[model samples]
Target: MKAEGGTTCGNSTKNDSTEEVKNQYHYPLTLPNYTKAEGGTTWKDKEQVFDKAPKRIMANTRPAAELLLHLGLGDKIVGVGADFGAPDKTVEKEYSKLNILSDKYVGKEVVLGTNPDLVFGRGGLFDNSDGRVGTVDTLNEMGINTYVLESSVTGGTYTSIYKDIKNLGKIFNVQDKAENFIKELKGRQEFISTKLSSIKEEKTFAYLHITDPKELNVEPAHDETFFNDVFKMVKLDNVFKNETGEVSVETLINANPDVLIIPDWNTYDGSSANKMKEALYANPKLSSMKAIKNKQIYAVDFNYMFGYSYNAIDGMDILAKEMYPDLFK
Candidate 1:
């Protein structure tokens, strides 16, 4: 027998006479690929286990939307939750073509209207909200299958991304596409790693969120967050390594790292990058820090640094090159 793609299976290839060809040809035919393997089995029957790609998929968060686009499944997406940012001009154009609106769904009516076969989301997007849009129970009650990407779970690393991609591929019946995407992503990560590995001097950095003049939050580098991974790759010491979750402004002032990294600062809001720096300078306690005194503060794209998508690698590259220009050069 042969699979639909014209690959031989079962008893092997046969000539026009329907006789087994044997190993007579210069190139022997390899056994058909099977999903499962057993011990001491000469050959197993090949089966196309899954079919019928998901017709309508609702992405509950920005990272999921980005991942789907990276996986070449953006066209399959029927709906996307709000908060997906299209910063790059090319990506913005593509997003416009897809008609992905960054609007929140207050009820299931819009999602149900799409008639989605599957719903994809990170746990927080559903959990942190009022449980109205993409909750598992709600979707299941509507006869829609829901899949949590799992990478949204805290402590997710590169390995988690690979596993999530594979799982998604299996669900969507696009394993080959998923494998190819993983290969490309992994290759890029490896290249970044190789570029950073030779650095002789590493900088000590701190990630600070300037909520206001009186309030600030600090994320430690060893907290298993995406930012943590990026800092680790560039061999920077995160001053907040001892703490998990957020920290007070006093803690940041005390740590006073070599490089101060801020996110979400360059917006229309009052906390623009320049304003944050000004605030830092005005604060006598923080102004004494080496980083502040030397003007070593840097701002990153808030969405990219906070998000765990292909862009996280981009963020890593930017941080690595910025922190150690000589090595990257």
Candidate 2:
């Protein structure tokens, strides 16, 4: 059968026999003389592959940190977002010396001063409505090519993150590094998938984002949230499957997941983790949930969950091991 772009990988309509057409003059072939060509002053000889590298790059999100690290071009960074949490100790120390965090979002003037060749970040960061620091149009007008990694628009996953890295590598002409990075991440994912597949009983889970003092937003596992992807990868059923987009406390109480994954507790103080547990346990309506009763509630770093990168792999491993020790062990 013909593929989406009218390209066939296997037997074509013209070549009905199972015999493979190894010539450049085949019916489906668009480019002629591609196979018969020899080393000469041809199109391939004159084709100019760009060796020019981007002098400076500005990252406006946390995921960019991983991509930049993988590229091993951290020195090219003229400015980084306040939220770019580098896990590498060497990079972190170098970044601290740069003292770029004090200004939060690097001003357009500061970025311009650095003369960045490219600006990479999530598209949402450019929104002026929610106090966005920069704009793609503004950067474009100033002759700076800006790439808003589209992986963040959908659910973040290891596949998506790898795609992002590959895309960046293509743009930066670092395809070799990108391929190696993807291979490593895929190996890790396969290892985790194999381990979890052995488990007979998969635990039900609910992930919540506590945005306010009294409000708990239940994140559905099958929706746009990346955490859902993590849970599904480990064969865990999301209790709030029916719910969509920031579920209410009533929904949380109704579904009552076997385990609740609390993301981002840095905003609270005074034994906030304990208090969150206590509050859930003390609540007459929610106290009966199996998760609360068994004290299975867990908190993870906000950066690990929210940021779209290999960090999610870390979060997945942590969650999987916590929820099912028998499988992960």
TM-score of each: 0.72, 0.71
lDDT of 1 at 133: 57
As a TM-score, model 2 comes out at 0.71
- What lDDT would candidate 1 get against the real structure? 0.61
Across residues 165-257, which tens digit of lDDT does each residue of candidate 2 receive? 776666565577788988977887888888877676767888777644256667674544555565666777777766646677777777777
Name the TM-score of candidate 1: 0.72
| Stretches of candidate 2 exceeding 4 Å from the true structure | 1-51, 84-99, 102-113, 200-202, 211-214, 219-225, 241-246, 266-275
For model 1 the local lDDT of residue 70 reads 61
State how far residue 229 of model 1 sits from its true place (Å): 2.4
Position 34, candidate 1: lDDT = 20
- Shift of residue 7 alpha carbon in model 1, Å: 22
